[model samples]
Target: MVKIGIADTTFARFDMGKAAIDELKRNCSAQIVRYTVPGIKDLPVACKKLFDEQHCDIVMALGMPGSKPVDKTCAHEASMGIIICQLMTGRHIIEVFVHEDEAPDARELAALMEKRAREHALNVVKLMFKPKILEKEAGTGQRQGYEDVGPARI
Candidate 1:
C-alpha cells in the first residue's frame, strides 16, 4: 500500500489536516501518517521526519499564516524551508498554505482552508496514480480554494 504523510501546525486556527485526510481516505487506499507541530516554521522538519522515520511516499505540509506582516515573513521562510526539504528528499511535498488575510471573514477562511486542503489531496492522488490527469490539466489555471481562473487567451 502507498504511504502518505501529513504535516500540519497548531498555529493554524483551522484543521486543514482533517480535510486532507478525509479527502485521501475517500479517494485512495494509501496509509496516512500525520505529524503535528506548533507552528509553520516547524513543518519542514516534521515532514522530513515523516519521510525518514515513518517512510512516507509523499507529504502534504499545511499551514495558515496570520494576517500580520510578521506572519507573512514567517510563512515565506517556512515555504522556503519546505522547498529545500523537497529537494533534499527528492520527493514531493505539496505545500498547502492559506493566509488568514485571504478571506474577509472567519467562515470564508475556514472554507478556503478545507477546499484547498482537499483539492491538494486529490492532486496527490493524481500524482501518485494518474500523472496523465494532471498533465492534461496543466496551464488551465486550476485554483484549489477559489474558482479556477481557467486558461487565459494567448
Candidate 2:
C-alpha cells in the first residue's frame, strides 16, 4: 500500500483546519496526523517520519494561509494556480481552501487533485485536506480550498 501522511496545525481563530481534517478523513486514502506544535522543529518531524518510517511516497501538508482575502476571481484563479504548482511536485499537496464557502470538500478536492496528479504521471504519495470557509465566517475576507503536491518532483 502507498502510504500517505497528512499533517495539520490547529487554527485558533477558526474551525477550518479541523473541518479540513474531517473532510480529508471522509475522502482521501492517506493516514491523517494532527500536529499542534508552536515551532517548526516539532512539525517537520512528521514529514521525516513519512519519508523515513512509513516511507510514504508523498507528503501533503494542510494549513491556513493567513492573509487578507482578495476578490473572488483573483482568489479562485490564484488558488487553482497554486494547486497546479503543487501538482507539479509529483506529490499531492491538498492546500487549505482559500474560498471555503465556495470550494468543494475533501472528497471532491481529492478527485480533482488526483486527476491532476495523473496528468503528470505522478503517483500520489500524500493527500492534503483544506477546508471550505467556516460556515460562520462566510462572506468574510477569508478564502479556503484544498491543494495537493504534483508531478514536478517526478
Candidate 3:
C-alpha cells in the first residue's frame, strides 16, 4: 500500500496538518504517516526519518514560518535539507509553508492554512496516482496558495 509522510511543525497551528490528512483520506487510498517537530529547522530530520525509516512513498513538509527574517532563514535551511533528502531517497517531498505574515489576522491565517493544506493534499494524490489532473491545472496556474490566472485571460 502507498504511504504518505506528513512532517509538520509544533509551533504552527495543528489545523493545517489535520486538514491535509482529511483531504488525503477523502481523495486517496494511501496510508497517512505523520511526524511533528518543534520548528522549521527540525523538519529535515523528521522528514528524513519518515522517508528512510518509515519508507513512505512521498513526504509533505508543512510549517508556518514566523514573521521574522531569522525564521525565514531557518525555513530556507530546512528546505535545503528537504531537497537533499529527496535527492538521496529518490522520492518527492512536498514543501508547504504558510508564513505567519501571509494573513492579516489569526482567523484569516487559519483559513489560508486549511486552504493551502487541502489543496496540497490533492496535489499529493495527483503526483502519486493522477498526474493528469495537475497537467490540466497548469492551464490556469492552479496551485496551493495561488490565485488561479486562467490561460492569460486572453
Output the TM-score of candidate 1: 0.98
TM-score of each: 0.98, 0.36, 0.93
Residue 143 error, candidate 1, Å: 0.4
- Work out candidate 2's RMSD over C-alphas: 13.3
Clashes of 2: 33
Q: Model 2, 1-154: lDDT tens per residue?
A: 5455554445323433345445545555556454443322233554555455655555544433333364345445535654554455454444333323332465554443343323211212222232232343344443122243332432
Candidate 3 minimal-lDDT segment of 10 residues: 145-154
With candidate 3 superimposed using the best TM-score fit, by how many Å does residue 152's alpha carbon deviate from the native?
Answer: 3.4
lDDT of 1 at 46: 98
lDDT, candidate 3, at 33? 95
Candidate scoring better on lDDT of 1 and 3? 1
lDDT of each: 0.96, 0.41, 0.89
lDDT of 2 at 5: 54
Comparing 1 with 2 on TM-score, the higher-scoring candidate is: 1
Q: lDDT (0-100) at residue 90 of candidate 3?
A: 92
Write the number of the candidate with greater TM-score, choosing between 2 and 3.
Answer: 3
